[model samples]
Target: MRVNAKSQKPKTPKGFIGPIGFDLPSIMPIVFAIIVFFSAVSYSYTTVNEKNNVLDSIESSIKIADILKGNSYLFFDATDSGAKNKFASNCEKAVNIAQSKNINFAATFVKLDSSSSIEWLIENKESEIDSCTTADGKHLCWCGFSPKKFDSNLSKQFWSISFPVTVDVKPPGSGPEDIYPQSYLRKIIVVVWK
Candidate 1:
């Protein structure tokens, strides 16, 4: 008996279109929709992860700064040897606090000396910084780094703040003119990474 092989159905390749209810054009939109949906989901997931990473780094840095700020601030005497010791102790405390939380850190104060020269001093320095007070450079301006030096910092998320050091939080005023003038300011810089 001879078989009519012409009437047999042919197999469709895995990725090729097969004879179905409609042509490929009708199904193209569904395929495109699935692709777009997945792409959107992936993009959103990545964006959220990046934002969380930045937020975490910044929050940790703030915690570290708060540790230092709370211990000894607003009274940073750049010219006094005793004050220098206190600053160093505070720096050690800040570093330890940060280290305990698994965060690497370094902090220093940069101020103008008696001769109008910049003094780059760290926490554990024994410099007889002459009375920097009368020389219009008595404020405590600080710079900090986390995970690495400022120049070698690899993290994209970081924060830096510099303002005149004041004994009062708001300068004891309520009017706009009473607002504190930005002069002889103290600088504080902080950076973080994941």
Candidate 2:
């Protein structure tokens, strides 16, 4: 018996004709995958950038607090409760320091377990809000510029920190026993904003 063989043409879908016609379907998955990958990458980049900004603000606030605490002019004597004649000058220096670092600074000396509070600010419009005052009308022995914002804009990144500090309070003197100074623990609140 003689063998006979015939080859048949591959079938093509209707209207599918051209050299690149079949390539579109094959390339679609690749194109879709690229779009998905890029979208994910872009989203991750934005999230990371936002987080970094927040972290930088937090770090700068901490640094400002440390600088204020270490400033000899501002906290001249941890034992001396009374402000020196140059105390205002020292606070201005602190504000200048914070401004140099591109941030705003504010400090509140709050007496523990008492309504007495002292605000250290630059005495500007923004600082006029009386952040240290309580709803019960906090008593202020001294309310003046100490720490301050570098800019007039109040809307910005802000952080606050409070720590304990010892201060010597001079009692009213009339007799020999009034000469001794009383020590009190005060809370120093440091606020930093950019």
Best by TM-score: 1
* True-structure RMSD, every candidate: 10.9, 10.6
What's the residue-level lDDT of 49 in candidate 1?
A: 98
Q: Work out the TM-score per prediction.
A: 0.50, 0.49
Give per-residue CA lDDT, model 1, range 1-194, as digits (tens). 88878657675566774566447777799899999999999999999998886676667677766655553344434333244424445556766766676655444333333222121232322122222231243323332332323242443344432222222122222243443322333444444444
Give the per-residue Cα lDDT of candidate 2 at 54. 68
Indicate the residue-level lDDT of 60 in model 2.
61
- The alpha-carbon lDDT assigned to residue 57 of candidate 1 equals 61
CA lDDT of each candidate?
0.46, 0.49
Query: 61-118, model 2: which lDDT tens digit per residue?
Result: 5665554444322222222333532333445556676667676656645555534332
Which candidate number maximizes lDDT?
A: 2
